[model samples]
Target: RGFFTSNRDGGQGYDDIYKFLETKRLLCEQELYGEITDLETSALLPDAKVSLFDSRFNLVSVTNSDEKGNYSFNVECGKTYNVRAEKIEYTTKEQKVTVDDKRGKTHLPIALEKSTCKVAIGDDLGKCFGIKMIYFDLDKYDIRREAAFDLEKILDVLSQNPTMKLDIRSHTDSRQTFKYNEILSEKRAKSTINWLIKNGVDPSRLTGRGYGETQLVNQCADGVKCSEEEHQLNRRSEFIITGL
Candidate 1:
């Protein structure tokens, strides 16, 4: 009898070859199509580092900026990546880039801003005390653009002194009932607290209290007619340094 290779054995070999060919085809397609562009300004920047990360922020690749402050990297299509740029004396910038199937190349430009001067915790707590309080409109607790700068400064102070504790106090004008004002004030205080927490402030170091119309900074008593500005002064949010 002649020796014969079984059909099963022949079929296994064919399947292995097919898989190998498919993998090679995929590699060739990726090499031909994947592309990316790095955009930067013609400014003298220090050693800037650029990195790409997956959706989970896992570092996929790292590259340094060219002399002209430019960096680039190739990424596969149909993937989402977070691009982060960093330098020593500059604020870190991050952007999200998504490569679409139709668009093979993406241009991502990042501009870095100068970092702000760091303030120490013990620098002068009284510097903020002079600012007095933040007043809100009736039944509203949103921090207006006018107060954003002060809040940013407060955040800076908190960042400088990581161990500092603050009491976020909320007050209201006497025009509203005590019970209603109390609830509104509390909501306002909590809203401000939430903003701070969202901006990276430690929640454990912050506590909130609502004084309603109980603590009046001005002489506008309950029965007295007061101007809008005077009433505003009474309806305020304040932060006090409880612990250092």
Candidate 2:
């Protein structure tokens, strides 16, 4: 018999408990059991929500961790599950777990780490230390919405360090003419640099360069058919901390 248990309170919460059990009964019809734990300093986090999603990243079920930071849910076997944890003042963590027919239960432990660096800004910003590789879509100079979040992080770092200089370099997949890609990549790099300048980052501290298809991170050579993801890797914008 499968059941739900928590150490927070006794029988007073039976109403919610019964409802949860009924949902679990329905879930058990097509799902296996999953146990999750937070391994951060052994501190219990009550009411932390745990959601399980399938291979396509669609939510399958949801549960909450007890005061002891423990959560369990019934999930389908032979499916990939993406587990996500959320809490205030702590960065969200995600992990992909696969369940197989041979296993009746899955135990997963997650650790949440803290961010230590101060935000960068203004004249002191030129001293920012971290350089991140930003990715882009095929032949597109415009930054993707997903890339904006990362750029914001970089902006925060720059805001904290006022005297830093960053060189923005753009690259493209080896599918186009060298001259064409070189010109397009340079334009892309400049576009990104312009975006930073417009967003409060100092213009003098930034430079842009286009490397075209000259820098290949993978083996897919020019004129060869490759996966979109592979080609996407070639189309990237990266930052280098050249001066501080």
Candidate 3:
């Protein structure tokens, strides 16, 4: 006699056990297990989606890697299968395996390379360099000694990428006359660029523009009264990536 389980109607529970004189034992499956990791660091990645597909390209099963980056699936013996692993911000990996007639388990591990942005055209150098703005005294257009620290970051990027080009945008608070502010901002922008040129940056890779009071960040325009902090926000400088 053999023991078996059935979920047929009128069963006392979800699955009821029964004794039978004739039955067939099932042993046509093999266990497949593996881990997912970062290609560069080899660090295990969790919650990565794992998929199994048959020889005909039909999806068989799907599972997610556990917190330990481990996943498993049961595949039929003598059948060829495809396995795929994927996660956000990483490249996907696909592999093929065959479960031989000999009953045994299979092990597979996949690593994915992280995605990166090599270069960005609209990237702001000031923000990238971790500085708010290059400092300049009132009515002055010369590069201050304090600004060197932040300016050096731009120099480094330009030196590393010789073919890269940048554009400088300068603005000032509405405390000064419109025309005067325009001229001062232009000088400030040029002064910022000149420092780069003096430090080995090519002049052809740099361009300067002065927006003056035209691009007031807040409502602190000519006739508007604003707090010192609010007005300070209007005074700024930006270096934008113009080309690769």
Please tell me which predicted candidate would have the highest lDDT against the true structure: 3
How are the candidates ranked when ordered by TM-score, highest leading? 2, 3, 1
lDDT of 2 by residue, 1-244 (tens): 4456554555666443433333443332234333334455656666766767666655677788776777777766567777766554444566788876553677776665443434333322212333346788877888765565346556755665577687787899898789999998998898889889889987898987999999988987876778988988888887776676
lDDT for model 3: 0.79
Best by TM-score: 2
**Two-way lDDT contest, 1 vs 3, winner:** 3
Q: Write the per-residue lDDT of candidate 3 for residues 1-244, one digit (tens) a residue.
A: 8789999999999999988874675668888889999999999999998988786656789999999999999888788988877776664567888877667888888897784535588888656544457756667777754466457556655765688899999989888788999988898788888898898988999998998878877899878878887886777678888988
Return the TM-score for each candidate structure.
0.49, 0.51, 0.49
Model 1 ranges off by over 4 Å:
1-132
- Model 2's TM-score against the true structure: 0.51
In model 2, which regions exceed 4 Å deviation?
1-132
Model 1, 97-206: lDDT tens digits are 77665534567767766655443443334344334367688778888654553465566556756788888888988887889989889988998899899999989988
Q: Candidates' lDDT values, in order?
A: 0.68, 0.68, 0.79
Alpha carbon RMSD to native, model 2: 11.2
State the RMSD for candidate 3: 19.7
